[model samples]
Target chain A: MDIATVNALTYEDFVNVLGNVVEKCPLIAAAVWSGRPFLTLTALEAAIREFIDALPESGKEGVLRCHPDLAGRDLQSGTLTRESREEQAGAGMDALNSADASRMARLNQEYKERFGFPFVICARMNDKANILRQLSERCQNERAVERARGIEEVKKICRLRLEALVLTDAANKL
Target chain B: MDIATVNALTYEDFVNVLGNVVEKCPLIAAAVWSGRPFLTLTALEAAIREFIDALPESGKEGVLRCHPDLAGRDLQSGTLTRESREEQAGAGMDALNSADASRMARLNQEYKERFGFPFVICARMNDKANILRQLSERCQNERAVERARGIEEVKKICRLRLEALVLTDAANKL
Candidate 1:
């Protein structure tokens, strides 16, 4: 909606309105709720970003871990969020053949073994080949480095979600 | 440094050895080559991670465009090898901030003008508050989806560059 409308929203109302932007990380939106009366969407986005950035490393890891793998269990079991499902499909992840899927599974296992978390990437920005390439390449990184990379990917997913919510809300006059 | 001797190479030789795991992505070595052989490291790390599933999107307009604002110039400053710089830094983009970076730059400008890129999340992973959060967030996207998500983040960067000479040379070794 308009800046004035968002700026005036009640904390509960605000959370209900835009909190799913970060997948399971609702606290990010909740934490920034009181910072409302935002002069612009930019100001509001900044507030939310600050809250996430200020979180402890454990918190960040929690956020990264919250994301589903590119083509793992979530896809097979139909547990991925609609946004995630669509993003993965857009990246051509849904098109993997059995052999490629098997390879992907192997890489996924190897990656988790190496990095201690599921492999996460903004699938919306990738093709299946590139995603697999990254899965292989990043598995070789140090844990700390991979953790940072994972969080960074989380940030991208969140940003896209935020844009969709805010603009659609604004356009619809929600 | 043949594959047979790779198991016995000194740390220095190991870096000199399979260093080019990916064709063009050479910095993987400069960054972590010192870790060496890895025969024992993996065993130790696995013992430590019997712990941690993990943890855990955005506004419109401003959010999509947020990340393009970071100091991506560091990408072109030659401070980051095309590969190493892309991952630790963000989306594999160096020319993102440059107006003349490519046709992608043009689209990025048009995107901002139309729906444009949004500014949603903070770019840093763990906990630093930079207004460039969205900029960094977009950078986190895989080079592919990011290409469609915006020019600023392309997943293509993650693929092996496949230098014909190197592959042929390696094939000969095989």
Candidate 2:
């Protein structure tokens, strides 16, 4: 959508746009949409602040659920939108060979067995090797510890995505 | 302190233990202290989740402020406890050579100039060199973009610290 069109949206329309994704992850949806109209980029940030503040406690789990698994090869093909899949895996996958892929799969299984969820890490800055190293090390954490760490990683991912969205919207306007 | 001792704390005492640290970063304080009488480690986790959910919109900046500058070594000494310093920087001043020091200073200045605030990264998982590399690369981001990224990093750090605290408290009980 055009920046003007997005900017022209009423608060309800804005909220509705976000609400479409809210069920996929309500806390993030709320965090992305909960505040007043964002006139400037700064105001948009302030809106984000308001939304994060008002998010419900239960919403954190939803945020956690939105992340793709750490192993680039393991995520369900259709689970993430095309952009998200590219963002999470494209760079790292280029560097991974067959051995790395197998190791990642094994680690993924071990991590899920230990934590009851897929291993998640913010892939924006990490390369394939670094991610594999992290996965192997993190799998050693106790269930409780790993769970806490996983949630934190999810929060990081959401914040990055939010920023990207805002920036993209701003660039489109310019 | 023992879990019992922590449990015995009045709200005031709990606040005191956290000290001015929380006051300087109220969102983090809220996240740390929420859902009190934390019995199991999981209970503490629940409290942090509640705190993150309950955070005020105005508190986002405060939370972001709590992070030490990514390349500002002086702030690092003050921002992290001694143990954290060793873990993040690998042996403190002894570990910092002249080349490393200059790189950090340059990166620090460049980052602040570009982003308005000090550069912020969750250093828990990175060593000095890696952090310096990240600082150098991220300093290239435009102000609005980097500000958003910095806030995201701060959120990650806060999440990690909260988990560490809960795990430490749980270990104390055993």
Candidate 3:
């Protein structure tokens, strides 16, 4: 809907509308609820990003863990939120063949084993191959680097998903 | 890189090695390729009642369009395999929100419009949310009664790409 419409939502309504905007991180929306009457999508996104930016390291990891693995079990079992499902599919994670799927599953396992969290990438910016390749390449990085990279990817995901939640017509006026 | 070594691949090598098995499609892997050569995953998945059997028409829609929007700019951008970027991303169709990136752009537009060539479901299964949701919801149709349902989704996307040359892996496996 329009920003005007968004602006008119009650605090609870606003939270309900945007609670899933950032995959499993409703608190982001919850935290941003106090800063309502956002003039533009960017303003709203920035507020949420800022909250995430200031999050404690553990908190940040918690946010990271909130994301399901790319094409991981959640997609098949229907456990993922609507936003997460769309993001992974946009990246074409739904159509893998046997050989490629096995590799991704293994990569997901490895990335989790190494970093203690699932590999997180902005699937919108990537196709399945690229996501797999990056997951492979990133698995070699030091933990700190990968953590930072995951967050960066999360930022990209936020921007993409935020644009989704904010509606393009509303964004066009900006 | 050959099929023989697929099982022995380390997480890194595995990702680099079998990375493109499905290229644009991620579900084929999640559905078929499991940790123990795939049978275990699908069986265990079956036991959970998660196996995608005879997807509802909407579910079929998700399965069919699990491909990229053929002609998505990413193909021309040289970031993805030519076929996949198009089938998954659909470039020239600018209307889709970055969030809608999971659905093939032009194909999605066309499929919704025509219900034709673009909606071919590969018949494999996975539980990815976007795929399942699309599959479940899009499967609802009056198409069987009206042939028109099959043709609309394909026509909307002839220009951005009409390539029909890429060989399916089934041939490669053969």
TM-score of the first chain alone, every candidate: 0.88, 0.68, 0.91
Instruction: For each candidate, give the TM-score of chain B.
Output: 0.27, 0.65, 0.35
Off by over 4 Å in 1: A170-174, B1-174
Give one digit per residue, the lDDT tens place, for model 1 in A81-118.
Answer: 78888888899777889998999989987886665456
Residue-by-residue lDDT tens digits, candidate 2, A35-110 = 4345665555445434543545333323333344554432444555444576656547544678987888788777
Error of 3 at A167 (Å): 1.8
| CAPRI-style quality class for the chain A–B interface of candidate 3 | incorrect
TM-score attained by chain A of model 3: 0.91
The lDDT of model 3 is 0.53
Cα RMSDs, all models: 20.1, 20.5, 16.1
lDDT of 1 by residue, B1-174 (tens): 222343454332333333333212122222233232334433212211111111112221122222332333334565543334544356324434444345334433443333323222223231222323444455555533543453222112212222222233443332
**Candidate 3 lDDT by residue in tens digits, A1-174:** 777777776433554567666665554564465566788888988877776676545445645666777887888888777888877778778788889889999988988888765699888788877888898999999988887888888888888877776775433322
In the order shown, the candidates' DockQ scores are 0.02, 0.02, 0.02
Predicted candidate 2 versus true structure: per-residue lDDT over B46-151, tens digit per residue: 5544554355533333334334444354334465554345445552433567898787778777665554356676677666767877888988887657756766
